[model samples]
Target chain A: EPEVTQTPSHQVTQMGQEVILRCVPISNHLYFYWYRQILGQKVEFLVSFYNNEISEKSEIFDDQFSVERPDGSNFTLKIRSTKLEDSAMYFCASSSILAGVGEQYFGPGTRLTVT
Target chain B: GESVGLHLPTLSVQEGDNSIINCAYSNSASDYFIWYKQESGKGPQFIIDIRSNMDKRQGQRVTVLLNKTVKHLSLQIAATQPGDSAVYFCAENDNQGGKLIFGQGTELSVKP
Candidate 1:
């Protein structure tokens, strides 16, 4: 089965440094999303992207965060300035219109460690 | 504010037993619900999903039950095995841009 895949399984960066997490969604997927989970907490929605634009974003997705679909398959999330509280597991997900709008397939996730 | 939450933080059962995990969502507008399993160090894997129009759905050895009146959801695993141990999470779609709101996970432990 085709699955979403992310690069740099583990990332370590210092505070105030910029970090970009990359994801290659399933080739045919039309909608993409990013979510994060702090240790021992529930996963929180960050943002959703479709048609090369942000469709929706949560309060946590503030000025520092941005998402781009630079290419057909590559979707990326960039943090302009990393904060210690940003340390968490960042997950990328995608869904095809045929798969139903709500059924999303998730990638293994990139563990972001902000020191 | 909208949120999904698991009723229990952890559950232990003997191998070959059945397991039922419960969740509650405050968002009445959520029309879609999904159950996911996360093994250690891995991402959440899709288990099964049910739409608001359907009260129950089954797949493989798992079944999902949704009660719209109570805004509750449950995932039941039949004849659980040791490999079924993981942190299970219930998520509801906010219906806005398909953003999913996930619940705190319930850790399932199967003892042989």
Candidate 2:
């Protein structure tokens, strides 16, 4: 089965540095999303991208965060400046409108560690 | 405050036994619900989902029950095996941009 895949399974960066987390969503999906989970907390929605624009975002998705679909298959999340609290597992997910929005397929996730 | 939460933090069961995981949602407007399984170091894998219009839905060896009146959902696994051990999370679809509001996960440990 086709699945969502992410690059740089683990990322380590300085607090003030910028970092980009990349994801290649399932081949034919139209909608993409990003979510994060603190070490012991529930996964929280960050942002959703469709048609090259942000469709919806959470309060947690503040000024520091941006998402891009630079190419047909590559969707990325960039943090302008990392904070210690930003360290968490970031996940990329994709879904087809035909499959119902609730049926999202998730990638393994990229573990971001900022020091 | 819209949130989905689990009843228990951890559950241990013997092999060949049945396991039922429960979830509670505070959002009455949430119409779609999904259950996901996450093994160690992996992402949440979609298991099954149900719509509020229906009371029950079933997949192979797995069944999901939704009670919109009580604002509750449950996932039942029959004849659980070692592979069934994982953290399970219940999510409610926000109906916009396909955003899912997830619940705190319940850890299932199958003792073989």
The TM-score each candidate achieves on chain A is 0.96, 0.96
Q: Write the per-residue lDDT of candidate 1 for residues B1-112, one digit (tens) a residue.
A: 8889999999999999999999999999888899999988878899999989999999999999999999999999999999999999999985655788899999999999
Candidate whose lDDT is highest? 2
| Candidate 1 CAPRI level | medium
For model 1, how does the per-residue alpha-carbon lDDT over A1-115 read when each residue is reduced to its tens digit? 8999998999999999999999999999899999998988888989988888998999999999999999888999999999999999999999985233448899999999999
- The best candidate by TM-score is 2
Off by over 4 Å in 1: A98-102
Candidate 2: regions farther than 4 A off? A98-102
Candidate 2 lDDT over residue span A45-92, tens digit each: 999888899988999999999999999999999999999999999999
DockQ of all candidate complexes? 0.63, 0.66
Candidate 2 global lDDT? 0.93
